[model samples]
Target: MKTISWGIIGCGDVNEIKSGPAFNKINGSVLSAVMRRDKEKAADYARRHQVPSFYGDAQDLINDPGINAVYVATPPGPHEEYTIASLTAGKPVYVEKPMSLDAESCRRMAAAAAQTGTKLTVAHYRRALPMFRKVKTLLNEIGDVSLVTIRFFQPKASALVANSEENWRVDPAISGGGLFHDMAPHHIDLMLYFFGEPLSIHGHSANQAKMNRADDIVMGQLVFPGEVFCTGAWCFNVPKEFASDECEIIGSLGKIVFPFHGNEVSLHTGGEVAVHRFEHPQHIQQPMIAEVVRYFSGEAAENPCPAEAGIKVLTIIDRFTGK
Candidate 1:
């Protein structure tokens, strides 16, 4: 793992820009290979990305001698399988968010990493992004936090989902739920990062639209250790004009406000308001990928987003969905 040669499994839309190019952009990292069930598509992606090789099977990519680390970018359905295999083969791994199908599967991946003594990191990439990092830093200025509320109302006609011939994001069997399953991980992970683990989680979900296979609305609350509370609502059937995305952190002194997907933060304190704005990176996940490379190359001490943290997120999601 001297130079951190990488192998990627699954070529989803996220890989196209968010992560794939980042491997090559980092100092000690290289995108050595890629894999997809369709060999033609895999080769095409490799060619387009200037990767050295591609494979039709994930196992082949994992076993490739040129690759020292593996990135599992596939849907959650096969995350556990590929992650366990990569670890068993003595390869470090960076698995996508929502870690796996559920908390149990994440635990299995973590157990395999422990038994095999291999490194595994989860792609809660926001944990390393600039805007979100600023949000965490600003939490100190807000004084003792009391309550945080999140509202993400996306119109069904314009849901922000990955493009694909088969829409697995709304397929409960493969994605574990609907658009909420696809997007909630980032916000939920941020809450945990800001406020530690929760003592209890409670919520519910429903397919209010009846036009989709999975739930179109989800609402939940988290009880943080210091009695800090967080409640969120995610709705996909809202009218296009009513669609909104915002998070408000109310505190003893002042409060902070921001959107989960946007790059602006507003702070209110002492009867004054200040705002901060950031430009999105060409590769939004590059910051996290840089850290992951360091971790895999032994320059860093620990996993950036470990499986243990991922399990907590899955737990909250399950509680909210009543799984």
Candidate 2:
């Protein structure tokens, strides 16, 4: 694939701006086609985005001779099916985060890619964000790391607490679990990128809110290869005033603090503190999509966020959720 002519499956909200526009914006990349279960919506998306074609069935998009790569932007439930089909059609793939519904599905997707010799990557786009890169730099400046902690507390009124079947994020049948399954992958993937695979992981989760079948709270600890200790707590039933989203990394010399959802990165060392704030791009996933294009075009050596790395994060989530 010298130039990446892309076809996207499940062009929903995520595709509107986060990724869809990026395909055409990147060098040597084109938004050749798109697929959605709703033909009207798929046609509308294609017309609005200036894509050449649209399809009502995934296989039609996958088999499009004009498309050289596929982006599986659907929900977690069908990721493995669409991804494997795309690979079997001899096209590289860029699937959305959480990789698949479970570890076994992730492994199957990975195996399919291996079998077909097609490149596959997950949209753990945070790995390519400026704010996260700043965090990595601050970690390096903080010297030898000693411990790390992640905390996420949300008010009861947050949309994530919705228990309706319409809210697929909390619907286990489609989403695999709750918002934890949807959101935790970003943070966990970053943790894996910063520190290698965990040597040991112990964690637990519960439905403290009774708002949904999925767990609204989760707590876990991970021991990394260099004796680095890490802990994480996520709760969705906190008071509005008590809500928080932060991560702190303590090193032998000092510590760094930042929020996974915020723009600020703070560093404390030598009795001095500094804060750096990074504003996100309008099309947040464009940078990462550019990297993916580069990899597919053979301009880059490796995919930044590969299926193997994503599977590791899912495995960690499995240990916490007992799935």
Candidate 3:
């Protein structure tokens, strides 16, 4: 079997254990290098994660011939640049979503991937989660999916007020927007995965909790290919809100409820409900990152999250942002 080595561009929160360890554990894969702007932090991450090399600059790691792919975990603002650079270098990229702040950058990255003949994948990790896969199966089992609803409610601004300005999420330029852009891609992508493209959409967002640049609360309605209706919202500032990621699919036979009890899904059928859940102990990034290794080795048929899928999500996001 061919071996695939990986270099990670941003060795921050997401790479801790879930993703970093998987490179070494997955079949015929290795996490050979890592990079961060801070030299000491990058070196420390490399040491801790058992990566063979570390660099203070991203380009240095990407240029490594031993590295077959690069994972970009930086914030949304710079996703386009690094991802395009990696693809241009003829290395597959598994970038964290939202792929870019807007649609045009997504197009540019996709075009870069096509031009270079390299695999460009987005880390829409929800697709790799086991429980969500079951939901997809249940949907297929029960035909005539008519309505879908996904709700994601996070904390208010003050509630999550950081002592330092280092928390870039509050800045629209860095995060793309408020919770909608930061968090909605996961939910919205699930909508697209379960159903098809949304025919049309109408969206409204407001900074009810007080923030800069964009809305903390956003709600939108999407009409899917079969006239399937999906209503999704990201409400950040309520008197009380839990970290909720939920979806309800109402079908002719029955309805499936993915009540955000951890990352599991529940089914409601025959006037009674049963739980169908599979918890991924690893962080969402690991399996998808590992799969890229498989794709490169010809052990896998396709990228787990293809560039086109990210483009579709960006297309929807563009409609929401009106650009």
Using lDDT, give the best candidate's number. Answer: 1
lDDT of 3 by residue, 1-323 (tens): 38878898888865786577778887788889999888899999988877899999988988998888888988789899999899999988888889988878888999999899988878887777777777888886556889888777766653322233266766789877765776678777878787777789887767775656677877788999887998887777655536566778898878888753365666777777777657675555666666677777778887788877888887787776565
**Each candidate's lDDT (Cα)?**
0.92, 0.89, 0.78
Clashes of each: 0, 0, 0
lDDT of 2 at 92: 95
lDDT of 1: 0.92
Worst 10-residue stretch by lDDT in candidate 3?
Answer: 157-166
Report each candidate's C-alpha RMSD, comma-separated, in the order given. Answer: 0.9, 1.8, 2.4
| CA deviation > 4 Å runs, candidate 3 | 157-165, 241-244
Better of 2 and 3 by lDDT: 2
Residue 61 in candidate 2, Cα distance off native in Å: 0.4
Estimate the overall C-alpha local distance difference test score of candidate 2. 0.89
Quote the lDDT for 255 in model 1: 97
Q: Report the lDDT tens digits of candidate 1 across residue range 54-137.
A: 999999998899988999999989999999999999999999998998899899999999999999999999989889989999
**Model 1: how far is 321 from its true place, Å?**
0.2
User: Which regions of candidate 2 fall more than 4 Å away from where they truly are?
Assistant: 159-165
Q: For candidate 2, lDDT tens digit of each residue in 1-323?
A: 67899999988877887788988888899999999999999999999999889999999999899999999998899999999999999999999988998988999999999999999999999989999987877787888998999998887666433243257888788888888888889889999988889999999999998998888899989999889999999888889888888899999889999988778988999999998988998788898999999998899998889999978998999999888
